[model samples]
Target: MSPSMPDTPTPPLALSPPDLRPWRDGGSGVDHVHVRDSGRPGPTVMLQALTHGNELCGAIALDWLLRQQVRPLRGRLVLAFANMAAFERFDPNSPYASRCVDEDLNRVWDDAVLHGPRDSVELRRARALRPFIDAADVLLDLHSMQEAGAPPLAICGMTDKSLPLARALGQPATMLVDTGHAAGLRLIDRGGFADSASPRQALLIECGAHWEAISAELAIDVSLRFLRHLGVVDADWAESHLRCPLPERQRLLRVGEGIAARSQAFRFVMPTHHLMVIPRAGTLLAEDDGHRFFTPHDDCVLVMPSRRAGEAGQTMVRLGRYED
Candidate 1:
């Protein structure tokens, strides 16, 4: 049996989708992608937004930068609005329906999928954006969550290099270390970005709840910090726009497993919050049909518990543990 949809009404939309018509004919051959080059030699830092159309904070951040005329001081600054086809369909009345037009754009980054004959609205755009993504020496993919009021998270892809960069950024307060989903590879884990020996690094920030007013604020702050950290933008300008104070330290959570729902009956014992830590090893977290989920170890962290009803094979939540 299919799961029943949640009875709760969607939250009020607090963010206005920025007007992107001005960026349609960007300098980059690909539509909706803008590139700025500095004559001096430096790394190409790419700031990508709109990976998921429903996530508006990223687009807001990039739009703010463009309006401010922020450009690289030494390197190339690539500001890309990815998955614009999906973004174009964004409707405030049914926001989540437009996360992607077909398959998730973030999951199609693997070469096999990119090279294969399989087609999607998302796949085609990913292909067009691939060359620029490949050229980037540093990348920051802006994203947000479905759960309201959740704290911001830095999804540091599975590499030794990313954790340190997240540590250096120093906000967001929590960082998650995990491999890409079984569904497919994420853009952050694609190519040299995932290779420990490669200098290419990427960080995907889940700024806050999708459609929340604060999410846009956090996105812009993080974008400035990222540019400032890499010396891509002038220090004075970056500092001028940065509104958030740095967190004293950021905590790391290494995800051990992603729990996929096996049946429509899957449900948590109680409400779950993002980054909520279960204190006991055997405490019940959720149930699916007849099976129950328990914390694997003491103080297991629940990462991004699904706000919607779970469908079979959908990842409901990820379980992780804090690193000392």
Candidate 2:
């Protein structure tokens, strides 16, 4: 835990609603903004939706949070509908309409690309949202996975500033891995570096079931809880939203493979619902062609599998702490 919070509130903060925008996500046609209760001055928290495009729960959850008049235990808030284009393009009746139109928007968070020529819609939007990201002190890039029983998890890197949140949201699990900042894949994780210099806490909640309501509710509850715990909202309101107490200790799983990949034989993996103990050395993979498979250590509960199984990809993960 970093030495930033006190056992009690010294100076209360205020928060407004999250601001939304469509100008940044390119021209796929989905654009949105949500601003709430901004009269109070507090820390700036930005909640965004549709990072994966198909993850619908977060979008609804954002709508719920935006519609409320939240009393900040103390800061400002900014909410955005990240992918209005993809949201509009996909029909609820069609499950596989299109997770993305041109490219994966979640993977395209870079400032320099704003002026560069873009070959795809993903690049255009990434360039547009640079400023909102730059202004935020904390970002909860909400997402959902195609896994069963995800149990709601929060992932933060080695940033000490935001680690408190990981500890507080200790539900499914937490991991502190090197996100390959040079690759420009994880913008919020890498972009937040300027605020704390050393690692600052960032949240990537994998709620569960791409379109399930449970995932969305958990994401929203935990987010509001975060605001409360950190003085962003009234502690009472946040406390009312608590589903799970903070876990004393959480585990971090290393990516045995890249997060975005296909398992030729597996569609997805539910790590939290397993009973077998995982071994430390190899990976637990959906191998179809006789490659090898392994998991973490002797007693670890794994969650969130990249299910797009097929071919050997970098998305398979191994669990570990930053120092380990």
Candidate 3:
């Protein structure tokens, strides 16, 4: 197996964070929600960004959409910048510091959590945006990876609802079917979005590592393709801004489970990259204070292995495989 690159003292700041002050007021009743409806009437397509404040690729992509004045010809297009409070704290020197001011916005989508007494910057924003999210016929949440050199992939969740949409997109060769985090519910996992029979579908794409220029470009390319797929934007418009190669074929991986770091001392047997395939069953992968981890099955694949051992209960990496 190839060795992981040495940790950079500071990851290069490849792109500037977009200034989103103009979009804060929003067209919808809520803040950061802009909706444009075509009189012809079609699906209400939503493109969301800034779910995690540290993930700037999404913000840059949304900013481009607003700057280009991209509008729907048939369906309604909703451009939302979620968690502005956290995004306000983004600093190039500490790129990962502002993931969220209080709690992870992506994990607070559960109906109970939205309606409960627990309150924070993320929860409030998610609560205010639930109605808009529920109204979306198709949704795309943009994000970026934590580890450098990881390939971009479309996260289609554990269900088949998003599988067709994943295939329709022109970029990203790998599609991951995830069961989601045990810590909380994600927006993609909420209501009809995850139901196989429901017309409402959503996908989250990790567009390479945060703070990299390539991630922003990947976000824009994928977003354009997604808009084209829903007929929210014309092929001509999409083709004009296309900057990446279309995948010849796509592979599907079904995530089995996430391996949590028991403590800050957790360590992998060797540094692993995202999508690394393990050939044998019971292969040693990692170890914590007194705990050990091994592959549950043969041909096991590692998805998004973290460089940081991380605190207790944080996901170190996820184990997955090709869907047979």
Candidate with top lDDT is 1
Q: What is the lDDT of candidate 2?
A: 0.54
| TM-score sort, best first | 1, 3, 2
Summed backbone clashes in each candidate are 0, 50, 0
**Using Cα atoms with residue i matched to residue i, what is each candidate's TM-score against the true structure?**
0.96, 0.71, 0.95
Per-residue lDDT of candidate 1, residues 1-324 (tens digit) = 012124535789999899999988778888989999988899999999999987999999999999998878998999999988888998877777778888888899999999999998989999999999999999999998877898899998886679888887887899988866888899999999999889899999999988898899999999999999998988898998898777777888898668888887889998899889899999998888899988889998999887555568988888999896
Report the C-alpha lDDT of model 3 over 1-324, residue by residue, as the tens digit: 011223435588887889898988767889889999898889999999998887899999999999999889997899999989989998877767778888888888888899999989889899889999999999999988877767899998769779889998956988989888887888888889988878899999999888788899999999999998888898998889988898788899899778988898889988698999999999999989989999999999999887765358878889999974
Q: What is the C-alpha RMSD of each candidate to the true structure, in Å?
A: 2.3, 10.3, 3.1
Those runs of model 2 whose alpha carbons end farther than 4 Å from true positions after fitting are 1-31, 36-41, 71-74, 112-115, 158-161, 170-184, 194-200, 241-249, 254-277, 280-303, 306-324
Q: Write the per-residue lDDT of candidate 2 for residues 1-324, one digit (tens) a residue.
A: 001112322221111222333233323233454444456676667777777666766776676665565544445666777666666675545433446667667556654554566667666666656666676677777876554454555556434455566666555555444343333456555566434664344677766556555676676776776676566776776677666455566765443223333345533333333222355545454343444444534543343434344354534333332232
Q: Candidate 3: lDDT of 199? A: 85
Which model, 1 or 2, shows the larger TM-score?
1
Residue clash pairs of candidate 1: none
- Candidate 3 regions exceeding 4 Å error are 1-9
Tell me how far the alpha carbon of residue 278 in candidate 1 is from the true structure, in angstroms, after superposition.
Answer: 0.6
Model 1 TM-score, 2 decimals: 0.96
Candidate 3 achieves a global lDDT of: 0.86
TM-score for model 3? 0.95
